[model samples]
Target: MDIKLLVKLTSRAWALDILAHLHRGVPGRQATLLAATGAGRTAFGASLQHLMALGLVARNPGHGHPLRPEFILTAEGKAAAAKADAILRAAEVSAAGLLRKSWTVPVLALAARPQRFSGFKAGLGAITDRALSTSLQRLEAQDWVAREIDLSERVPFPVYRAVNAGGEISRVAEAAV
Candidate 1:
């Protein structure tokens, strides 16, 4: 989703992980934050600065013994997270494709049966012939899927099949279904 946490964080990957961890009830502790971020102590401090400056996180003071700092989302931070959630939900609604997050269902469907052009179109749901062809071609180029050119008559038909079988997209497709 559109968590501006993504926009605010220094590295998109770490930012996303941190926000997701928080959303899942992981409280922000220094050691855990470092682990979650995959950041060295020095880098972690820089990241924390960004998070704080963005108003998405703050130091939780009460829990510390010798003044150790526990990081937490401020109200504004939570609001941003919520907004991100809403943006993600809205995208799923509008695009009818959450494949970016979870391609499991679609990936499985494709894997279970790589299809000829017609069948592929039907399975993918309401894709235009041109877009469908383009996507198939692109997937073929990426080696994620293969297209065997079928030619017996006037037109060329291609049957698609999974190449990697279990990449990120495949996992997402599998999860979706």
Candidate 2:
């Protein structure tokens, strides 16, 4: 699967929530989905449009009154949602939960290239030291990132590198960009 495609699918507001809810395998009416996702009408509509565009979801033309549309997962949608469900289940922190944190995805993406603290600060100019430190620590605790001391350098500085999971996220983000 294209990591970019996954990132693009998940990054939009309410996208994962919609997918997660739909992954339940029950066709849902617009009202039901709106209630289940707790998304505002505008955001829900937008997300639905986006998912349909990606061919992950489709209208159940045979079901529901014309005034109230129903939706179901397409074959590709089911496969993608299944993968997303697995990722969420396997995560120490849910993927959606992690993305909720500011700067988490960007920081993870940069860390994939193996960066020092200073490098992170420089690369993400808007991120505060405390936020960067917290993100790095969180990622390390989750085992998505590895921290190493550079003994070869005159002044040993700590470097953060993305593990396989982090690399996976970075690839997704890269594709989104």
Candidate 3:
């Protein structure tokens, strides 16, 4: 029931986005989803594979390619996506509540650009280095943000980018607007 537990760990935003899309109902076909999500074929295919592996989606016998097959969400997958949706929604609520005047306003500002820890730290304005670090770490751990470390140098700077997560963010933002 606790949403925090769900957001605590996930691979990436796309993973959650894929789940949210599946949760809408079992997809009839990959082409239908590709058109719905506007995601490229490669991205859609990979996500579909993962969903199937997780039992969130399964091959639905129908007109796919005549040789291969089509896919749809399983009952278990629908249940899982629903759970993920709730947890992500709760996390966003919690995060929004924590916001003050300029506290994290700028990080949200970067909603357009893919940002890293250092860039966000610089944008947060009044937050302490420690606080920003904590927030980013929490977000990363919860699968809200994808962390990438560039080890090209001896010292790596980690970057954080937000994930879609079951369309929770999209739904919440649209509702707010």
Candidate 4:
């Protein structure tokens, strides 16, 4: 997926979780998805709406009760869902919370190689320094990203690389984009 779309997907709470569950073949009903993702009703509804607005998901026509709607992945959604599933599988369960953060996926995706802070800032475009720092720290804390000090120059600087699960996620994000 593209970085912009990936950022949009991860920005909202429960959006990634919803996509992952749906990709796993969980029924796309509100209740079923809520149960599977363990998201609160309000957040779940918002994420579902966001997906619909993105044209990745849609309500099934002529199906189910009016009060109980069923959702399905659009052609675009299936590809996105597949990517979401791959990302979820690549991440450790403990990393789920990080995945929900706005900059996490975008940062990881950009960290396909060891990059400096400026590189990330330039790549992500709108990401602020503090936000990028925080995202990198969180990913580092999760051990998905590894920070190495580069002393090759007069001044040493830190370089971040996606390691382990982060590496896997980066690969998935970079795929077909």
Candidate 5:
């Protein structure tokens, strides 16, 4: 699982949503997936093609019109989709929403290594304080990140680390990058 591959999968618009929807084991047809994911034809087509290229998904042979194909997860796709489902279930965040945010995955990666607020901001470079704060708060709210107060110094400071969910996300992201 190359980190770059994970990032590539997550970075595409509506890619995670498509995977998550498929993971539910419901309709695997084009129309149903479009309705479930609310993705337009172009985005859905591109994503499906990308998934197929990665061997994560495939068209069911002779299942539908060539113009409107039915899809199924390949063996590798099932495993990856299972991991995606687990990530969503554990984080309580929509895959689409999580991946759409610019700093979410990077912040998760940094938090996985345990860092203070300043460190996170610095590592991300050019991200405003408000953005960093908001990203951290979102992760914390989802229980993916744990924040602790460091009191060793005269004035205490807070540090953040990835919880189990965050760690999983980090692993996924690291492998992709």
Candidate 6:
């Protein structure tokens, strides 16, 4: 649940979904996982490959036919899967999709309190302004984040804070940290 690992896990669209399903005891066959995650074959395959590259997932040798291999979580994968499950559980089913986005969880994790735009940019390191803006707008639309205008300064600014399900997700993300 290190920040870097969390960022890598979220880099792929379906990686966390795959991990959550695996942690929930779903069979790890490609088809089974594909069905469970509701992910397309190619994207799911890519995410699965990404997980393997991260050493969080590995093929179970001698466990299945060559054409249909079974995947097992490595020890590190189990820990990560647990965190993924916690995150998904914290989010509403509809909002789970936002969690799949690159910056959402990281942003939420940092937004446990109100923050300015620059605060988020500084904390997240490499996120582009457009990406951060899009993620914030989406979360705001979902009512997961609330944006308030700060008029105290000569130049007005917007501050973002996690609310509702977003607050829960932020708690989970902070706990992982």
RMSD of each: 11.1, 5.7, 13.2, 1.4, 4.9, 1.2
Clashes (candidate 6): 0
lDDT of 4 by residue, 40-101 (tens): 89988999999999999999999879999999999999999998888878888876787888
Off by over 4 Å in 4: none
Clash counts for the predictions, in order:
12, 0, 2, 0, 10, 0
Which residue pairs overlap in candidate 5's backbone? 2-175, 2-176, 3-174, 3-175, 3-176, 3-177, 4-176, 4-177, 5-176, 6-176
**Tens-digit lDDT track for model 1 on 17-47?**
4544555567688787677546567755765
List model 6 lDDT by residue over 28-63, tens digit each.
899999999999999999999999999999999889
- Best of the candidates, TM-score: 6
User: Order of candidates by TM-score, top first?
Assistant: 6, 4, 5, 2, 3, 1
Candidate 6 — which pairs collide? none
Judged by lDDT relative to the true structure, which candidate is superior, 5 or 6? 6
Query: What TM-score, over all chains together, does every model reach?
Result: 0.41, 0.60, 0.43, 0.94, 0.64, 0.95
lDDT of 2 by residue, 1-177 (tens): 454565457546766667767897545788888887778999788888888999898888788888888888889888777665554444445455675455666676677678899998887676688988998998888778899999998989999987867767665454333
* lDDT tens readout by residue for model 3, 1-177: 122222221322244556666667646566666776566777667767766766677887655786457766678666666754543454454453222212222333343246666676555445578867766565555555567787777987776666644134423322322
Q: Cα deviation in Å at residue 45, candidate 5?
A: 2.7
Better of 2 and 5 by lDDT: 5
Model 2: C-alpha RMSD to truth? 5.7
Better of 1 and 5 by lDDT: 5
